[model samples]
Structures are given as C-alpha cells and as structure tokens.
Target: MNKEARLSRLTRMALGRESSDYLSRDVDELTMVEELKNKYGLENVYRFDVGKNIDGFSPLIQDVLETPELLGLITGSLTEYPENSYQRLRRQLSLHHDIPPEWFVFGAGLESVIDHIARAVLDPGDHVLIPVPNFDVFQSVSFRMGASLTFMEMPGLCWDGNILESLCRKMKEKTYRLVWLSNPVNPTGQFIPQDDIHRLLSHASETRTLVVVDEAYGEYTDRPHAVRSASSLLKSYPNLMVLRTFSKVHCLPSARVGYMAASSERLRQATNTYRPMFPFSWFSLYMAQLAVLDGDYVNEIRRRNQERKKCFFNRIRQQDSGLETFMFLESDTNTLMFRHRDLGADALHGLLAERGFLTANLNRLTGIQNQGFLRMTLHGDAVNEKFLDACRWCGRHLFR
Candidate 1:
C-alpha cells in the first residue's frame, strides 16, 4: 500500500485545509513569546497576542496552590481515577447557572468540546452554518468531520442586527445539521445581542439544527444583575448548546477545563458520549471548582477588564494628530482587534515584532474579506502604556 493511500481521506482533507497563518498551531502564544525572547533578548519582548496573559489567578485560587492536599495529589494519582467524575465542579457550575448538573459535558478545553460537538452532531456531507470572522476551530472541526460548510460573513467583525435577523430568517430555509456561534466572538471580541441569538435559536429549533454558542469570553460580557450568556436560553430553546471554558476570564488556560450546557436530554447524551474520558487532571478540576466558587473575583476581573479596555481606547482616540495612524475597533470583551489605517496587518505585525511586541496577525482568518487587522489581548497598565508608546512611535514615523 502506498503511504498517502494509507491515510484516511478526511485526514488528508483536514491537512490540506490547515492554515500556516493561524497562531494556534504547535507554535502557541507562549512558544512565540519564548522564540521572540530568544531573538530580541528577554527584557525587550512583550506578549500582546494571548488573552491568557491577563492578571494573576484570583487570590482565592492562589491560596489553593499553597495547600498540602493539592500538592499530595501530584504523586498520589497515577493509579487512582477521579472518583466523582468532576461532579463537584459540575455542581458548582450548575448552582452558579441555576441549571441541572447532568446537562453539562466536560472536555479538556473548548477545542476538545468543539471536537466532541462535531462528532456528536455532524455526519458525512452534513451542512454546518458558521458566522465567519469568528474562531477558526469551528470550521476546522466541522470540516474534519466530513461536513460541508456555509458561512455568514460579518465584514466589520461585528454582526449588524438587521443583517443577522435576515440570516435567521433564511436559516430555516436550509437544512443544516450544526450551527456554530461565538458570543463575544474571538479575534474581534464583538458580541451578538441576546435578541439576535434568540432569533437564530428559534429558526434553528424549527430546522432541528444543533446550535452551539461558544461563550469562551462570556464572563467579560455578563453583568451582575443581567444575563448575557446564551446558556440562559437553554430552557427556551431545546436546540441550543452553550460552550464555556475556564480558560478566558477565569485565567485557567493551563487547566484545560471546558464544558457545554444543553437543555435537550438527547443532545446532552450524545455530547456526553463523545466527550474525552478523564478530560481534566485532579489539580485542574480542583482549581476550576475553586474558581467557580469565587464569583466576586470573577466579577472583579470583568470590571477591571472593562476599565483597562476603556482606558486604552480613550488613549488611542486622544492621541496627538501625528499619531493617529492606528484605529481601535470596538469590542465587548478583554480581547480587542484593531487595525492601522495606513499599514496592512502583516506590515504592522512585522513592525511591532521589530519593536519587541507580539500581536495576532488577522489577515486571512475570515471569509468576507480580510481587513489587514491585528488583535491583542489587554494587559496591565504598565504593559498597555508601553504598547501605546510603541504604537505612537510607529504612528509618528508613518504620519510624519
């Protein structure tokens, strides 16, 4: 048998579809930082690319690392399995959301959850509807599952309510097995209003399509008294499933803990069947359980995230006339995507790299036109100020 012939058709197809431009490959954010540090020296390089670089783990979470019990788990758990299958974490999350614990399906991360969703819902030649300028994972996972894709493009990275309404109306006309959505969308951080999502959900329900809303950044958008997560609509829309991760606002990307909630028992059973066994480490599960319990800390992260973003945006708008080359796109979350009016995203990315700053190059990450946009996750005050200075220096040179 020939070497290429031995590979599955789906594997070959997925390989052909992989983009070298995407940063989520083997060269991840930290690896990029380390490589840059090697080239530019340690003290000079700044990481503006990854959202996981946000403020420290909550003090409540920090306290757990100091515990003797958690340390003992490191050496003790080689043979023993997790006894409760993460029931404690699920219970905490259920109580937090006022949902049934059994509705939750745990995965190693949102990436894993997404893969499970594709496995559970997609079949060969099945149709999947995705709104582009969103996470690439949805497209990759679905395609790998032998699903054909239809994309609704949001050119400005923010969905116009009217346009989304139109799409919702047309969605019922098509037979899609899966509908992928990202609330507080990745790269751009723009959110679809609940009403718009509800409309989509209604249409999807009629079509019997499984609508998966990825709420990885839901913490940044959900308020104290108000609800923003589509998880809130699970009861109202049985066709809906909401994906959440500990990676974003909880600052637990290292934990590899993510889960999805669906009110439909059938969907829940399918997802649960597809989920990876022992998806979380003992420590990771404990950390997530603690993180969920500390609601006040999560609230603080949300508030401070907004404050930092607002300050950064204000500074950009108020920059001197000569330094007006860059434009900040409005975003609803801590991660923001912006662009240079004069320079292309690749050019700006190279320029920033030369200046010892790393940012996400958002050139071909979308379907309805690439805007030469670059994205950055908001950092602390000192780091943001330094990044602003780098921008000012670049702006002055361009505008002068």
Candidate 2:
C-alpha cells in the first residue's frame, strides 16, 4: 500500500478504538440503579457511575461545593475568562512544582495536551520514541499526528541503565523530535527512579529532543510531591516537559483538567498556537481547587490507596499455588498487574465483570500474548475484599 493509504488505514483503526469507552463493562455493575427504582417505585433508574469513583469523592466534594467563597472565586474567574482557564490552572500547578508560571500550557486533559504537542512538534513521517505497555492514548496521538512511533520496552521489573543507552543509540541514528514516557507507568504502576529520569533528560538534551514525562499518577504515590522536584531537571535540560493531571489523584476524571511544564518560551508558543478553553465546567474547577489545596484529603487518599494495595497484593500471594500469579514490578501504587496459569485474561475479565468486578485486560493493553495477566485497581478494605473474593472464586472454578 502507498504511504497515504497505510496512514489512512491506521487512522481508521485508532479512531475506532479511541471512540469506544474501554471500561463500559464495569458500568453494568451498579445494580442499585434499577434495583432502587423497582424497590422505591421511582420513575427512572438513578444510576451512579461507580466505575468513575476510583478515588472516592463524596463528603469532601459536598463540603467544597457548600463554601460560598470557593464558588465566588470560580464565578469571578469565569467573568473575565483569561485566554484559557487551562493556562491559569497550569500556572497554579507550576507553582506547586516551583516552576515559573510562564513555563507551561493548559489543555483540557493530558490526552489533548499530548495531541497538541505531537501536532506542533512532529512533521509527517517523523519518528517519535515511546515506551510500550503505555496508555492507548499515546498510540492514537502518534497515529493522528502522522508520526511514526518507535517502541522501546522498559527495563523489566525496574528501570535499567541500558534503556538509556538504547535510547541514546536511537537518537544517534535519527533526529527524533520527541520521547514520551510515564513516570509511574500505567497498568504496570512502576515508578522510574530519579537517577533514570535524570539520565533520560540528559540524553534528550544531548540529542536536542523534547522529553515528555507523563506524571498523571504521581500524586497517588507515597511521595505525592516527587514530581514537583522533577521540574528542576528542566533548568539544565531545555528539552524536557512534565505532564500532570487532576484526573487520577483528585478523582476528577470528568473535570478534564491537565497541564504541561516546559521553558517559558515553549509555553508561550504552545499557548499561542493551540489555546485550550475552559472545557472543564465551573463546578469542576471549584471541586479541583478544593481537592488540590486540601492537603489532608490528598494525604488521606494516598494512605488509603497504599493500604489497599498492600492488602490486595498480600491476598494475591496467599492464593493457591495452582494459579500462576505474577506481581507487578512496582507494588506501591494501587494498581496490580498479574498473570495466572490457565485462564485467558479476556475470559477472566468477563468472569469478573459478571460478578460485579472490573479489571484491565493487559493482553489487550500491551498487545502482549499473555493468557492470564490482568490489571486491578485497589480501592479500599471493603472493595479489596470483594475483588479478592471474586479472584478466589475464579481460581477455584475457572482454573480447576
């Protein structure tokens, strides 16, 4: 096929995959919607999207909305809307990172920011380096921008020095424009060490390539502020940008607020070229400000996430030896990636979904040929127990 024809085909596949919400099966679990309607004689099923609340936002959100001052700030800010609230949010985020306010652009979300970055920086046929087993949005962005994505596997189990050497080698062969990576990787939940991050930044500077570090899950880590220190690397390495969001940690996925930090000049160019509007609602901004500023809420969520992770992993280890379970490289985060001996991930996922449990099928995520590997997110004691019970049931019935 001609290059154009091939590109068109790839775009079609990417668009189809991106258009569908991958976690719909999980939504089917909220039996209370219809059950409550039938029991209470309500007119319609008042469905609560349970899957959306990975980070519980009940009493805290309610309290934030009740504050008149907070609401006033949101309304006042909206009156003379700055070029973009995204930019203002980016400035607030940079303050946390100790990065200058001028060093970033605000986008509706990390996905949009990445898409804009790809379009702004890469020409058709340009090569972009990315680590595999990443969020699927990276593939969509790369394909949409007409850039050829070059995949590099992360060092297994941990960050390896050789990965940097390999990246340096690739840089020498071609003048690649961008290198995109997640700090604490999605699905795997592994955090690359500070040394490795520095090495990657150095390599990027040497190659004159931009290194985009996606730190979406940074706040969920034990060191909720480690990513703040990461911004310091940009001082010496102009070719570095850090991406952060309120989605994962703040549990504000519906807010759609994410931003990037780079040199002030880069930020200016990005804002001028692709100015992101207030895609997020006023209520979202109010809630996000409340969430971010409340240190207690952030720390409590992190602590709970850590506790849940430990409980889940401990239970997994105690499972019968007949089930082949492989733990993720990084165990600190709330997500666990594992592989079993017999059951295929798809079948296992379906079985779990039927029982009101939802997990990420790694087989589909990494495109790795693993029959039994799946990723589960840890919520709390009650939720963790429910998940473990589901797994145990699956082990006895499916594996047997």
Q: In candidate 1, what are the lDDT values of residues 77-180, reduced to their tens digit? A: 76677544677877888877878888888888999989988888888899888887778888888889999888887755568876676567657677889888
Clashes of each: 0, 0
Report lDDT per candidate: 0.80, 0.66
lDDT of 2: 0.66
Q: Would you give me the overall lDDT of model 1?
A: 0.80
Estimated TM-score per prediction? 0.93, 0.81
Pairs of residues at least 3 apart in sequence or in different chains that clash in candidate 2: none
lDDT of 2 at 4: 57
Model 1 alpha-carbon drift over 4 Å, by segment:
28-32, 225-227, 319-322, 396-400
Model 2 earns a TM-score of: 0.81
